[model samples]
Target: YRVHLEHYMTELLDLTVAAFDYESKTPTYLLTQFLSGIDWSVGTVNLISSIDLKSDKRITILKALTLLAGECKGELDFLENRVVDLKSQIGSNTQLHLRYDKNCDYIEKISDTSQLCTRLYCYGRDSLTIESVNEGIEYLDSAYINNYKYRKEKTIYTNIEVASDLKTYAEAYLAIYELPFLTYKVNLADLAKREIWQHEIINLGDTLRIYDDDLSLNVKVRVKKITKDYVSENIYLEFVNYLYLPKFDNIAEEVAYLSEVISNIVSYDDPTKVSVDAIDDLPTIL
Candidate 1:
């Protein structure tokens, strides 16, 4: 008992420190490794202490991630101000139009494959807030697109879906995109006839389709990504709401602690709300 308790106590101390080190949203993969190694079979005293410490550690990391998001957003706004200033500098020899849209470049700075979840957290102290598609609506109202616009309401009929193990995500996505929102008014015939939505479709790729209850209504959408595991796609549906983007500020904050995505989807899956800033990834907004 003495040896076991002593060893666990020491481990608890080390883990506590590890957690604090990551309190600022720094994504050190080594910490994930360390967490995977935690036995947690120690006596009550050590086990309890470890759990409390870990929770605190994760919370701090989340706050740090939020700060990082703010920092990235600040960079974007700074660039926007510069563009405005440039637009104001119209001289006599000015061209027909001043296409001063460098926003894409700033967006790329943040969206660079490098600034993905882990790296994003570690990039700065004052991170950005990852709001849900519903929560970030106000931000997009000022012309910053929060959602993508579909070419038109298009739907293809198929008993296919993309996730089995991910029931919550699958269901939530369906609820958000499935004609239920638009009252199943999407046009099924036009989608198949013109196949504009399917224009981007390739073998083993995701294509957004609009589904109507009776070919009377139209719901616009785009298919984002397909599951690598589901080949037949018979019961696996993959889709993204061209109109709704789920914000993940808290979720992003938690990324520093979680080594996987098991909990992320569960945290926020309600489909009723739409977020405009979530359109950051898509090319166009309708």
Candidate 2:
């Protein structure tokens, strides 16, 4: 697994920094200020767009960086010699495809919908509401709302005072809450093999495609975690925004069974054939 910035910058003395609001500033500028506050050096930065940071209290430098990244859809790359780089986003432009075969131990998926919210009522500082940005509607709806039969509503409160900034915050919140928590677990020892490693390598935040023809499933997901044991020659990975259930064989069997049931229902004749009794002048079933 690659190193995380939080781990390297974990010194108690260098962790927390005084927060101040920086308006009409690019993310790169805010990042530099936080690093400078902690006396850390900076390197190349490729971030774009101006955003607001509404921090009024002291916050961890990591938290400050996270908020800045989230607002801009960007990520930080901690480089050698304590230099930090901010990019528009992390991961490779060329997505690699991984297929299930003998090397794959299994693929498992997990989903949690307990916190799913289709609509949100967001409140900003000074009694500002999402109503203005939401076309005069009292709340904002997720684009995924139509996927569900009924609406799931939730309320969110933020310290942001600007309408445009509040819109950004609420939309981000809705996007996360509207989707069910999904994760895919996969173990592929073959990825450690020199032959495979030479062809492709995966890292955190990279997008990947999974192919399983027998299960009739092909999905694209982002890598959330990775583990490798060099001594054991094993590699394990976790992905997000993927399908549900576990083990390809079980899912395939369930799908086949459902398909057969539908086939049988379609082929079966109607059982409502009825006849009338002429003498009694009463309806009778045949």
Instruction: Return the top candidate by TM-score.
Output: 2
- Listed per candidate, the RMSD to the true structure in angstroms reads 23.5, 18.1
Candidate 1, position 21, lDDT: 38
Report the lDDT of model 2 for residue 78: 58
* Inter-residue clash pairs, candidate 2: none
Q: lDDT by residue for model 1 over 46-135, one digit each (tens)?
A: 011111112334433224322332322211101211111011111122111101131011100011112111111011123222223224
TM-score of each: 0.21, 0.56
